[model samples]
Target: MLFATEVDAPGVAALERVVLDAERAGYAFVTFPDTPRRPGIEAGVRAAYLARRTTRIGLAPTLHATTTEPFHLATQLASLDHASLGRAGWVVGATTAAEDLATVGRTGAGDGEVADVVEVARRLWDSWEDDAIIRDVATGRFLDPRKVHHVDFEGSGFSVVGPLITPRPPQGQVVVIGSDELTAVLDVALDVALVRATDVAEIATRVAAARAAGAALVFADVPASFDPSLVEGLVDGVHFHGGPPPVITASPHGATLRETLGLPRPLNRFAVTS
Candidate 1:
């Protein structure tokens, strides 16, 4: 996931070039931030464009799930997935600070309600099942009404209606990810896990917990600032090298995320958590 953190429109061109270069360099996805500047300045739409411009590279707004409407968020995310031919992942995070909540007119609501928000987001993702679409012009039938199901989600934090406007995304549903403690939901549901920590032991702990919480992929985080010299030390520091433990995610010093994750060579995928 190459993060496009450019804060201006002009920077988008540079981001697009970088994503194309990364894709050629063996990168898999292009992920950006969801900091919508104003009406018509749609950031997610830009992300979708990035996905559309490149083939085989996934698109995601990793760790930007705090200040947005759940319904709008789901629709746009599904649109991105569909528009991208099923290569979108969403990394959901909470607004831990009061100002972030207030940014969206949310006040006094920053009381660890992230999991609830994540639940609602997932329900919205699953609101519509596959095969819900029917382009039948013969009988003026367009949808299998039964295939579209209401989410009927009423979490303490919020609720979402069923049947997203777009058909169920080709990826079935966009990958719903939660960083850190957001992985403790008893149901233990998520397609991917990212362990953003400087310490191998700490990340290993998180990977184990996430696996127990039921995750498919866990990517260890090693920031770009990680010294290349330290790679040897970190490799030696991998908790379970010879034998596989329940879960051990190790982030080694490298220039790109693929290097850190032992995925040959490629572009980066970190927002710096060290």
Candidate 2:
């Protein structure tokens, strides 16, 4: 099974040290949890910075669907994927805290709205075909406009028009993960589901249910002090948070996050074929 951990360092130096150490220790991926408690760098920006520093581990940053614009959220993640050489994942979040809402001057997003944001982000990622960039110096044309299509997605309270400002990400689409509790309430599919439970049996039950709900991978979210062996056979991976890091086997080296996780790169939905 694979293993992952959350790094909530207070400063950039500490962040780099933890992430690099995690990579050397053989973790598949490292996530940055976004919260008011740690207020300096935004999670996405921190992930982008670490993308250039770490070579093998996947970088996933918690991005809320409610506070950010869909277009910007999609673009930021697409940019992260490019910077990380196809090793980017997004932990989908929808915060309902009154303080968070006040800062954004908005109300909490419903489950349907959150699901729509995820769908729109995915569609925007596919708006540009893989072959869209055709740099022909002789013709002086940088791209084939025909290969780029408009997403034209309308959902919840907003609408997005045409193609994204950026091209498709290296992984075709960055992996999307959500908490099991959130996934159960939303109607969107996730690449990975993070399950939190009290015991091994509950973890197993949640993992099974998450799989049934269309999560390609299911990870048990446990405290860093928890034993990995307890849920060894029950999950595809273990995601640790807070406390000391758990001892685990190393993940395979020199592969993208999707590759390491055995998740296939998705096909561009707007691509044309003969």
1-274, model 2: which lDDT tens digit per residue? 8999999987899889989888988898998899633478999999999998999999999998888889999999999999999899999987878788667787665548889999999999999999899999999999999998888888888899958988999989899988987678877679999997759889988899899998999999999988888988889999999855666677676478899899998888777441
Candidate RMSDs in Å, in order, are: 10.3, 1.5
- lDDT (0 to 1) per candidate: 0.54, 0.88
Mind giving the per-residue lDDT tens digits that candidate 1 earns over 1-274?
Answer: 2221112234678767766655554444444544423334356766776866877555666444567767777788878777777766676755546766666776655344555566666556666555556889998998867666677766657776665677766665576644545676434355555555767577667777877786655555455444323334322121111111122122222332222223332111110110
Q: Model 2: runs farther than 4 Å from truth?
A: 36-38, 272-274
Q: Model 2, 39: alpha-carbon shift in Å? A: 1.8
- What C-alpha lDDT does candidate 2 achieve relative to the native structure? 0.88
Error of 1 at 269 (Å): 32
4, model 1: CA deviation in Å?
12
Residue pairs in steric clash, candidate 1? Answer: 29-58, 151-162
Q: Who wins the lDDT comparison?
A: 2
